[model samples]
Target: MREVKGFNMTQTINVVDAMCGAGKTSWAIQHINENIGQNRKLAFGDSGEPMKYIYVTPFLNEVERIRQATDIDFFEPEVKGTKIKSFKALITLGKSVATTHELFKKLDLDILDAIEEKGYTLIMDEVASVLEQYDISKSDIKLLIDNGTIEIGENDKVIWLDDDYKGKFSDMKILAESDNLILQNGIAMFWTMNTRAFEAFDEVYVLTYMFDGQTQCKYYEANDIKFKKYSVEKSGDHYELIDYDPTIEPRKETYEKLNIYVDDESNKKKSPLNSNYDSREKLTNQQRSSQLSSTWFRKTATPRDLKQLNNNLRNYFRQVQPTENEYIFWTTISDFAPTLKNPKCKWNKSNDRTSDNFVALNARATNSYGNCTSMAYVYNRFINPMERNFFREYGIEVDQDKLAVSDLIQFLFRGCIRNDEPMNCYIPAERMRSLLKDWSEFKI
Candidate 1:
């Protein structure tokens, strides 16, 4: 380990990128211990008081796991000299503390005050999840509220929302407000996860297990000495690595290629067939109807059928002298058929005539259309059915019916449009064309 003073800085950050079961947590503990030993002292706060080492994880289960492991190791007489303590114990003793990233959002003022007064190292486990939970934006809040997934209160505050929606929004708000305070206190942050969680950071260490089951570490720093290499070994639940060697070359082709697509214009490279396609071009009634139907299902319109429907819609709109009965019949079928595939007949009293749920349903339909672009990609990567199923498998109490509906709706909406306008009010001509293009390109 390098000198602690050399590594400790106001913006000191480190990311431990490794695969599951790669002993990242074990490696982090060992690294912290070595740094503490090298400094011959632990980190202190602005109050000049000794600060505690904090380990933050995404879940309570992880906190319990680390607590159990640390309790067993620290009690050994050989390791008794290490003055390690859990966040809970630290809080009870009125000392600096550690906690899960979720709990960090709900931390009381007193605990936060202590953290601001005393600098500490924050070891964040499952860094990817933490980043996702905390990366909240005002736009996300507005979307949830507008889509009826959440509701604001009289105080202009989010008082009632879906479980996941409420939690994510609250945590994002807290983290956004408090992160600067925590950082300004000169705390060091260590992140352990599979993916890079931040755009800017002080350093990053990648841990890879070779084919022979040996773990290799590659360190990247900001200054002139750009990289260093080391070999790591696991002893029980802890890890140890060889001294940094600048001469070591990275193993050739040892890294896995991730086929991740970014949702940015630059990354949305033009396909040869779509090179001339314009997202903003206005389409005729026939072209618009065909584009909208194309989003619903492939081969939805033969050229003949599309031309007939387009003509009917145009004639219905042109009927200024038509009876009220004829006007209602045509308009209702034109708007409702694409969504429910059933006409609003006079005999059906159960059918909703108002456009109360139209916007929401249209938003859902649009989302479903978008997801069909890459069904496999959306299903495996975006859906969380397994998480919900885990409760049922274990006989845990939950609103299974609600969960099922919510899950289905969420899956349908994944990567979908959130336009609040009802299909009856106006067809999203441009959006439909864009979705058609996306589906076409994906098929290609």
Candidate 2:
């Protein structure tokens, strides 16, 4: 491996920012197959070694897809006990493997040594969740500091002084050991991706849409990791990689198929629901936050408002645009999802799923909901305030509103529209609706 600091920035990074449903995965499959064939031809060369590959995606089904497509043996890390041991075994054996993003993120500092041993190309099916709002109460943070179990440095970087510690905060000890935990303003804790994880790869490819609007993109910028942009393009029968053209938007017709709900006297609700949320750029942060947000559904909305919103949800599924019993995809905060769930509209096609059609409001990188034609974006999208604050603390600027729209498009694309079919969406939040409209029309 080259000196970690000596790798050429451009040579190491390639981002395939194709529009959703543009076959980014297809292109990746083709790239891997070709690389394998080329490697085999050079088996007689001086090194006589085939380069290894590590493919990580958001779902297990996708891992299976790549593993099944090629003739090469792709190992799905089996837990003899823990995932870290299984994954390190695959890398240490120098095998081309496929795995889920969750397991990929669970990898520890020791795995880096195994990765650095060879030239492995890394293909990330979707940008991993590199930053998250760590759920630790303020009381816990204060207690840890007071007990001499932790120390805080500049940028509120949390250092775990208690390595041998195990118990209530064993999870904290594990994260600190990985060297990615951070405390924002000594209040909010976040688990950041250890950027050094990608250092040993010959090259890295991240496939997704609106890459600029993703938190991973900002995280990469903050880490000074430079990447080049590419997109999946269909030349004729097959998909291939090409320089990403912002002007070239494939399948715009599918976006035209969305029918956003607009409430009036004719609708079940006497007034427009969450209509005060429009002109989001002009609203104060607090004002913008309270409208159609998860917090609003949980705390801000009055009983009367909740009843009306619940009725509106039912109206959309039962009356406004009654389903043909196609899997109905809807989303809101998990706690309030039950109250707002339309009666008898929850489609249970599979017994395995806990919430058959209740996809998380911020979900992405899955095709499980592609069959869903009737989708309800019950909650408005908002950039987590901590997300914005984290970037700000690093003096890195991010466009929150742009990221909001980017998220909406990725989530909405999970519906039948992803299959290029018409979808009737119930997005009563005017601000989210407008954002979708503006983005669809290429005004973004």
Q: Considering every candidate listed, which one attains the maximal lDDT? A: 2
Prediction 1 TM-score vs. true = 0.31
With a 3 Å backbone cut-off (N, CA, C), the pairs that clash in candidate 1 are 45-118, 45-119, 367-416
Name the runs in model 2 displaced over 4 angstroms: 1-12, 39-47, 263-290, 344-355
Q: Which ten residues in a row have the lowest lDDT in candidate 1?
A: 373-382
Write model 1 residue lDDT over 264-325, tens digit each, in one string: 36767533222212233465665543343323223343444434434433332243222222
Each candidate's TM vs. the true structure?
A: 0.31, 0.89
**C-alpha positional error of residue 66 in candidate 1 after TM-score superposition, expressed in Å:** 1.1
Q: What are the per-residue Cα lDDT tens digits for candidate 2 across 326-392?
A: 5688877667766665563453344335546678766777888898888888667666777888888
Top of the candidates by TM-score? 2
Over 4 Å off in model 1, which ranges?
Answer: 1-10, 31-51, 71-98, 108-110, 128-238, 241-444
